[model samples]
Target chain A: MTEFIPPGTRFHALPSPFPCKRGGALHGARVAYETWGALDADAGNAILIVTGLSPDAHAAANEANPAPGWWEAMIGPGKPIDTDRWFVVCVNSLGSCKGSTGPASINPASGELYRLDFPELSIEDGARAAVDVVRALGVEQLACVIGNSMGGMTALAVLLLHPGIARSHINISGSAQALPFSIAIRSLQREAIRLDPRWNGGHYDNEAYPESGMRMARKLGVITYRSALEWDGRFGRVRLDSDQADDDPFGLEFQVESYLEGHARRFVRFFDPNCYLYLSRSMDWFDLAEYGDGDVLAGLASIRVDKALAIGANTDILFPVQQQQQVADGLRAGGADARFIGLESPQGHDAFLVDFERFGPAVRGFLDEL
Target chain B: MTEFIPPGTRFHALPSPFPCKRGGALHGARVAYETWGALDADAGNAILIVTGLSPDAHAAANEANPAPGWWEAMIGPGKPIDTDRWFVVCVNSLGSCKGSTGPASINPASGELYRLDFPELSIEDGARAAVDVVRALGVEQLACVIGNSMGGMTALAVLLLHPGIARSHINISGSAQALPFSIAIRSLQREAIRLDPRWNGGHYDNEAYPESGMRMARKLGVITYRSALEWDGRFGRVRLDSDQADDDPFGLEFQVESYLEGHARRFVRFFDPNCYLYLSRSMDWFDLAEYGDGDVLAGLASIRVDKALAIGANTDILFPVQQQQQVADGLRAGGADARFIGLESPQGHDAFLVDFERFGPAVRGFLDEL
Candidate 1:
């Protein structure tokens, strides 16, 4: 038996009216979200966990379908998130595949999948949708908003774009502006997808999916998500199999290669190719300073959040410790209660997911202070 | 004016009997090399400079073709290599394109280019070719054998394989064994070449070459050659052209991508795809312990080098600082006067090429002791 939402549980769909950059007037674009636990009569004690690039409202608790939520370990009873003490809400991000108005979602007018006709989505747009989800849940304000990776970036965006949405924010292993190296890497990944023969300019319905392209993209990502020293220490010169001779061409020659291949294969099965492109482009276009007249501190000043915790991993070359320092400095200059934690973890940018023993305690401490 | 190597300078084609791993034998497979300055009466002033994977015997002196030698800055008149005093010799290794017996060389049996039929060449074979070059120069012992990257690995191999060939060794960012991550990255580069439709199983003729695959390989190599931090700092989110908006479909969007593309394009023109594959494979197969019952120290014990300098760069993730430490540790354990120097440079593995101000002093200081 699995846990289920009570029959009387309230769900809301709040639509927005904003003209997209691609000349599409998006009307009645409602966000779908689910709330767990009780919101105090004063609409306080609410915690919002923003979902990642492709996840949905089912990001905390495992439902009757029983698919493990992305953050199942952190959100359940006695977990760091502790839904019993606070009302937790998560929404399907804009331009996502899972029940969101993405490329795969059907258009109301034509009754056809939006496909390549979808509007370009920005981080601001995604954050706006998240705000709508909270407002529709009858919550005037959130105690805190926490997110990881891209979701972390979105949490920062929520603070900047939506006034007084959250009292505090937790940004884990993310940056306000995507770095140039990241943009370059993501450009190559996008090229891989666009170069695929089956892509046909993102209109491949009856043909095979761009799997080879997706695999290449995932391989590039694996290189960024972990430290070279970690890879060398864990798998230096190690063969995939002990029994195979050096001359065997088809055998698993290197352990790191085998690990990358496994990750690439799994990512291809679960991820959408077009969504990957859109989200990568969104990340590249994100520059908070640019929006605030090239002053990052001014952008932080615009955010109404009372406090912030900027967390980074020492080995995370993708989102380095320096970037976290920049965020903390900017927030402090803006008179916000900002602190930074540079954790020593060899798992690189993915440390937030792997080093939960340390991360869970840090999150609990931050939330306890609130 | 650039000084040139005068025509009619005496050169030697030293062909040694090298044993191949896959049975059979190759005789008179000469290593072509050039020498500058005078070998002392006792032939004790000889300094051997081992070239990296793609470079040839023209390591210092300018050629008639107007293209500068790869190490011209370091090996010329008053430079670190100092051809004015030290008798500097550089050889085209066993499996190379310039006047060496590589895949393009003629096969003895069929009198045709070996091509795909070429034997798998190991780092040991490359070192043996260098040894043959040294012997042919009439020098009984080398004052020093200096190398960078793959060439550094070859220098280590020489010390282990032929003890009396060199009295001192300088390894610039080298590793005794290729890490699994390195092998995996190199394997993908090789596969990028092999999977190209134009590769034709390495049988592509002179007219038709795998330009796309070679470009991809170079693109991948460029990423490893430079640090992500450097890339971001130098070309952060800057568009190649200001006129192009964020939504532009064609042309490079970021400056880093353009830089990588430029590097890849230039590399394809001067470098052979087949040679890149063979050399990377040679690097992947480099493991000193494989020759001495799986004991790396035991293998290096045969080397009679008096002093060894293992140098590394701070930002070099490809051949990192720890790798240089491994070289120093191995040589020290083998009773050699080993010293480790970790240079702080932001140029990544290519720091040895660009950071000549620091590299010059380090090299001169090490050689001054001799």
Candidate 2:
């Protein structure tokens, strides 16, 4: 029997043969998730929150920890998400490393880590996994569903693949299809991990982590997540204090180098290299039009949600504001009351995470209306 | 006794003990150079051209190799540079591998490849080496000095360090100093090279090249050199035909991936990783403010050139058009005849090389006036 743990919650296993989008099946797969507030008697007040590539399921704070969550500022009683009014469910992505069913998880048949043997994943798979968790909890219909970055793509997939799962939707910093520039960037990142000698063809021992490759890949990712405009204003051309006895040309001289290093180092502590490889590829392969017989508007039409909100950062090159506008336009054309909000930000694709002041109010307004 | 090669000719060595900007000098250092057209009476019509990080001394087609040069379409008889009217000389930058004294060159003292032992190079060192070559050829004064990308930075340094060597300057797609974003990108690239176990601290045998690392770095470089606008227009979300028997997430699915792979492969065939490291760092270390004791305008004032031209591409994120405008403004404020021209392009930082039609006209107009 699954224990009903309070907020800062633990995970529960999904039934066997979890269907994946591409082909292979996941046996006895599980999803790690967290929750806040109480589910209504009718089980109609649940809000499912999906996350980006790196964030965990800890989207909001709980009484057990009380220290604050990743989105604590905007997810409290009076905040945009309003935990007092709505039961928020945040799921750790299926292909992620945070206690989720991923390449790092043990395979039931072989009794060993799946590694590269893990089924090829897609955004649709992630969305379906979240829906499975929701249904397992005896929820007939969700009040709303929200997603950011990778989550945004998954949320759209969930609505398209399983219609009427939620009454409303919120997609943030995501695209209808992966742009070539983004695909190229992610491809280089995978190459960085795979080229590392220690990767060992995805069979590396736990002790022999692909540290250098993972760090390099994370560094590149950080560069893309944020904007050059922000870096210029923050670090500029200022030199950092160094300990080198002689001038090392390749040494960390600029403050920006130090900033990138700090971020990359922090990421390597939690993220798995193989999981990064798999999840990044899944995001690159995502295309909403695939579900509608190569017609994006048709796919949008398939989403039966009553309302939708599409939020974008003007400076986001990964998922440009234009793509977000397309999401809003597509949904509106498909008979859903959709609203698009383009926020001016120097934070680029990361603005949704960093600029909660502007984001929170917009989200609150959208949710209150629903 | 030096060989007197004709116009459209081959290389000649710069004298030994090539003086560098910071501390120790390069021993037995030599520069490879190519020329077009005849040096006129009094040698007053010579034009010096400096290239970017990758290009060699072969800026235009010559008698030796009838095949066109990298900039052949823009540097011939009736082209922007007009070889028939002015003697044009293109030198391989110091610390570059193409027929120049670089990490790939043998060290006179150790009798082995200099590799990392190659002294930390600076843009000023590149300028000085080019000046030495010009002096060796009996040229008293250059009619103009032209630089593109890395060359542009070197051209500025030449004017600041050796004020009266050239009468005019054309700075294209280059910056007065490295921006934070660029520094971060370059730092990650260097990490990619260092992280490769095959690099062996720059001591790897020729046969055991760090091919994967170099290819990864080049791929990242290619992505940054071009813009997302161009990639979106060219490749979009079209999938390339793949031979994978089963669904592989890491498969080459996008045409953009193929394009990047092709470019990376071609670059790895010619570029030395160590040389790339040195030159990339040299660019990061460059700052015009240092020349004038921390005053950029003061440094610009030190350039005793008759006139200057600063051309920037609209889509260039590496060295932005705003930075180029600053260059023009600084020169004009410093009592020099300076003009700034912003060209619309989807090619980004590479516009100077790829969109020669737009670039050629601007350069020709600037040179014709001078």
Candidate topping lDDT: 2
lDDT of 1 by residue, B284-337 (tens): 888877865786656555556789999978888778888888888878877889
Give the range where candidate 1 chain A is weakest over 10 consecutive residues by summed lDDT: A1-10
Across B1-370, the per-residue lDDT of candidate 2 in tens digits comes to 0111224445556666766677777877888888888899899889999989988888878776576778888888989999888899999888888877888888898998888888889999999888888877778689988988888889898888786898888889887888898888888888788777777788766688778878888898988888899988999888777662225447577899888988987887578888889899999988898877887666776677888899989888788887778778777777779999999989999988889878989999988887
| Number of the top-ranking candidate, with TM-score as the measure | 2
DockQ of each: 0.48, 0.84
> What's candidate 2's DockQ score?
0.84
For candidate 2, the TM-score of chain A alone versus the native chain A is 0.95
Give candidate 1's whole-model lDDT. Answer: 0.73
What is the C-alpha lDDT profile of model 2 across A146-213, one tens digit per residue? 99998989999888877789999999998787889899999999988887788878977658878888
Tell me each candidate's RMSD, in Å, in order.
Answer: 4.5, 3.5
Where in model 2 is the C-alpha error above 4 Å?
A1-7, A243-249, B1-9, B243-249
DockQ (model 1, Cα): 0.48
**Best by the DockQ measure:** 2
lDDT against the true structure, each candidate: 0.73, 0.83
**Alpha-carbon shift of residue A185 in model 2 (angstroms):** 0.8
A1-370 per-residue lDDT for model 1 (tens digits):
0112322223444454556643564555555565667888998989887765655667655443355566666776677877778888876667766555566666666777666666777877778777877877778899998877778778888888777888988888877788876776677777666756566677665347777667777877788788876787888777766654345342247878778888888787566677678777888878778756876666766666788898978988778877777777777777789999998888888887778887788787888798
